[model samples]
Target: MFKHLKSDLPASVVVFFIALPLCLGIALASGAPLFSGLIAGIVGGIVVGALSGSHIGVSGPAAGLAAIVLVAIGTLGSWENFLLAVVLGGVIQLVFGFLKAGIIGYYFPSSVIKGMLTGIGIIIILKQIPHFFGYDADPEGDFAFFQVDGENTFSEILQTFNNISPGATLIALIGLGILILWSSVLSKKGKFFQLVQGPLVAVVIGIIFYNLTKGSDLWGISTDHLVSVPVPEDASSFLAQFSFPNFGAIGNPQIWVTAFTIALVASLETLLCVEATDKLDPHKRVTPTNRELLAQGTGNIISGLIGGLPITQVIVRSSANIQSGGRTKLSAIIHGFFLLISVILIPRLLNMIPLSVLAAVLFIVGYKLAKPALFKTMYDLGWKQFVPFIVTVLGIIFTDLLVGIALGLLVGIVVILIKSYQNSHFLHIEDKSNGKHKIKMTLAEEVTFFNKGAILKELDSLPRDTYLELDVRKTRYLDNDIIEILDDFAFKAQERNIDIHLISERGMVENPPSFIEFFKLRPKSA
Candidate 1:
């Protein structure tokens, strides 16, 4: 994976910028020490990324579980007790990974998976609009419908629109222009443009603007608009940031419950992210979800052993990595190092970089994810794919990540059922002779439980005293449930005075002893 160092390094820088504010904001929302979020980010990047099978996924403190973390900390009586729960949660996740529960990620539909990417893209674009305009009212990386800060996502955008900062807007526009120019033209010039990505350029420009505008009354972006990284005043203060779990709390039943909750939620969130990120991977690489779970478990264990919140594969950072041209997990690990070094050495310098520029970087990432061409392509595939895609998009934008995915999955399942019913094949009358009807029904290539209802309907609707021919010559596999449906129908066919003929790959059977018995007698070949 490290073979793509040229691409990975630049991508990692972009992800570092993207993940920085998110770590702090998520920690602030979780009601934990500011440094705890940084610890999670570092562990998630270095520990999880190193152990994971993913090519481009970046793990960190997640915004999805902020509410739960906030409430759990209070219920656990102290941060130390919460740390114990986090540790136990890591153990449970390790068990889950060993159990290979990650196979659940495969059950999600492709339509829903694509929808998740599109939805997240739209959400990123929508959520970052406020930050782009220099509205610092809401914390960074909050993807909820209702924010912990009491403002709705749309309302905050409106607020930002009303009170745009001149300096911030200028800097954002400049950053966006630089990104566009580099991607469109400068990138083709030489390796220099390739090595120095647009996002890095944007950051440099943002810092220059910050320094250049400090004395201008109308052009200065305030400290509120800058990236916020916690800076320790002294060596002892830095050492004091680490928090250890209290082993005495292990016996508490409530701690166990919290532990289970964190493990369950964090694992689920991580798996979902794994699916989404793989879909986003331009190489179409598949990550080993089980290994990802193990990596996340190890990271959480390490994070909890020190002082940090639970970690998961975060979409914002992962998406940023991909859009910035990350081709390997090296980008993720390197970003972790960036997080570690920044706080310890160059935090004040990082604080000088404006958030608007980072927001600009995210805007481009969002555009790529939710590109309009994607919607057109999905629409052309017909409603079966389009409806779920749009629903997932709307759900993520209107609700939150997990909820939107669930909604899309529900819609996808319903579409599958409908398709299954339709695929049971067509029934048509072939001939009528001597006051009797000859009916032919061609079975689909594969018939499963989903087709049982449709098959039963056709069986029940046959005319009395009719000749019915069931063709299974095209079918490669037949479910036992459908076979039983045929058996039950055979008894009823006799009652309705209907003659039955079965056609299969082997040969034709006229008036078989029993549909179930005949299928059983045949070699499993049919």
Candidate 2:
């Protein structure tokens, strides 16, 4: 992992700059103390990163769970009770890992996964637009269509148009301009430019811009428009920020229910991110899904023991790590350390950086994930693939991440069943011999109950006095329902004066007594 220190260090810096605001923002969105988000970020980075099999996946408090966390906190009656539920949730996830439930991730179609990445990309772009224009009414990490600020995604964008701050807009444009130049031109010029990423430069300039214009009424950026990290007055106050879970809540049935909810949702989100991150990996390394669940479970437990929110593998940071040239888990670990250190040592300095600069960085990340070329590429793949992909994208834009994926998966299953119904077998007509019609029917590789209708229809439509050649040379597994259909067809064939030839790996049989007996006599096909 250390072999790529030069690359990992710079990537970690980029992740750190991105994660800081997100940690605070997600905590704010969850209705939890801001410091709790940082705690989860630290634990997710160092603890989960160390245990995870993934090379580029980064874990943290997720925006997807903000609504759940907010409601659970109120429903459970106290923040301490909610923390207890988080710890219990982690235990449940560990159980799920031990039970080998990670295979659930493999069932998702590739079309849906690609759609998820694209949908998230569009969401990031939409959510950050207001921030890009100096509108700070909503938290930076809120990804839901309906926000906690009493406005939906589109309403917030419209609100930004009416409330743009001149200073924030000016610096945001400068930050975006610097990012484009550095990524497209300067980074290609030399190794030094590559070592120092564009986001770092943009953030530094944003801080300088904030300090330089502190006194100018028209150009000065307000506190509301900047990154907000809780500044501790002293060591005691900082330590006081950490809250312990109430063990007494363990007896409440509601706590158990909340625990199961978090476990299921967090595990699913982590599994999805693991799959998506593996696809984005340049080296194409596959992560062990069960091991990822174990790591996430452990992270959530530690986070809950402290005052942090629930933890999961997050796509935003994971994709940022991949795009910024992260080569190993060290980048994630180091980013966690950065979160731990900055909040302790230089939080006041961190609070000075403008939110618009981070928004500019996110704009680039969003563009990379949802490039215009991807839409045409999905469309070219045909309706079977494109329908699910397009549906997932629309669902995510109008609803939430999980709901969108669910909608896509449902559509994909319907497409599969339709294809199966039409592709059960192939029919070929042979030239007439002695005034008798001859037809050959070849079975598909695997004939299941789904293909029963197509196979039965073909048999029922056959004419009398015909010679039928039933070939099963390539069939591996034949369903019992199909065999019963063939048995009924055999009786009908005899009454209609049709002669049947059954072809198989074990050789041919002429007019077998029973279709079931014939298959039982032959060995199973490979």
Candidate 3:
């Protein structure tokens, strides 16, 4: 893992910058204390990172679970009760790992996965718009269509336009401009710019701008426009900020439900992240999914115990790690360490960085995920792929991530079934030989109940006095429903003077009494 330290160190720094605001934002959305988010981020990075087999996948507090956490906390009555469930959830995830449930990740279609990434990318861009414009009523980067505050995403943007803070807006624009220049122009100009990431540069400039405007009320910039990192004046004060779990609420049934909710949601999110990270890995390395589940479970268990929100492998952070040229697990591990050190050692400095600057950084990240070219590429793949892709995208945009994926998977399965029905049976006509018509009916690889309708339709369409040959040489499975259809067809064939030839792996028979009995019949004395 440490083989590529030169490349990994720089990438780690990039991922760290990208992860900082996200940790805070997700915590804010989850309705957990702000530091709780940082705790999850730290555990996801340091603990999960060390245990994970994935080289590039990064772990952190996920925005996807914010709504679930919010509801769970309310239902459970106290944050401590919620933490108990989180710990239990982690244990459940570990059991999933041991059970080898990680194989589920491999079953998801690639087209659907791509659509998911694209959909998330679009959501990130949309969610960050208000934050980029200096709107703070909502969390900095909440992506759900409906927010916890009861405002729809679109409505929030409209509201932002009316309640715009001029100072915050101006600084955000300047920060965004600098970020764009750094990424597009400056980074390309020399190695220096590349070594120093654009987001880092934007953050530094934002702090400097905030300081310059602090003394002068003439700039119209208020303290709210600046970063709101909680700064504790002393060690005792900082220690006071940490919240302990309420173990007394363990008997509540709602607590168990919340734990199950976190376990399921966090596990799914982690699986998706593992899949996405594998796709992004330049070397195309496959991460051990079961191990990843266990690692994430451990991270969540630790995070929850510490009063942090549940942890999962987060795609945004993982993608940033990959795009920034992270080559090893060290990048993820180091980022977590940075999270721990920064919050403890330099809380005052971190408090000075503006939210808008982070928004600009995420804007760039989102654009890369949902590039226009990706839509065009998917369309070119034809409707079989495009339909599911579009369905997934729209579902995610209009609803939430899981719902969109469920809808897309449903469509994809229908497509598969339709294709299966078409291929289940085939009729072949042979030239007349000795004044008799020869018709050959070949069954598909697997003729199940689902194929019964198609097979029955073809058999019913056969004309009278047609010499028929039933072939099942390659078939692996024959459902009882299909067996009945064939048995009935044999009786009708005899009445119509249709010659019946049954072919199987064993050999050929001129006449088979019944489909079920045909398998029961032994080869005629070799």
Best by TM-score: 2
Candidate 3 residue-wise lDDT, 1-526, digit = tens: 6788766787788788778888888888888898888888889999999999999999988888988888888888788888888888899899999999999888777878888888888888888777777777787547778887889878988988887766666777887798788767897898777777766777788888778877675554565655556777889987877667777877878878888788888888888778877987889999999999999999988988888889889888898888777899999999999888988899888877777777777787788888999999999999889888988888888898888888888988888888888999778999876677888988887877888789888888877777789888877778778888889988888887778888888889886877778765534321
Per-residue lDDT tens digits of candidate 1, residues 200-282?
88999899999999968799999999988878899898889899999987889999999999999999888888898988888
What is the lDDT, from 0 to 100, of the residue 374 in candidate 2?
94
Listed in order, each prediction's TM-score against the native is 0.93, 0.96, 0.93
Candidate 2, residue 302: how far the Cα is off, in Å: 0.4
How much lDDT does candidate 1 score?
0.89
Evaluate model 2: give its TM-score: 0.96
Better of 1 and 2 by lDDT: 2
Tens-digit lDDT string for candidate 2 (81-102): 9999999999999999999999
Separate clash counts for every candidate: 0, 0, 1
The runs of at least 3 residues in candidate 3 whose Cα sits more than 4 Å from the true structure, single-residue gaps closed, are 215-220, 248-251, 431-437, 521-526
- Worst lDDT 10-window in candidate 2: 517-526
RMSD in order of candidates: 2.4, 1.8, 2.7
Tell me which of candidates 1 and 3 scores higher on lDDT. Answer: 1
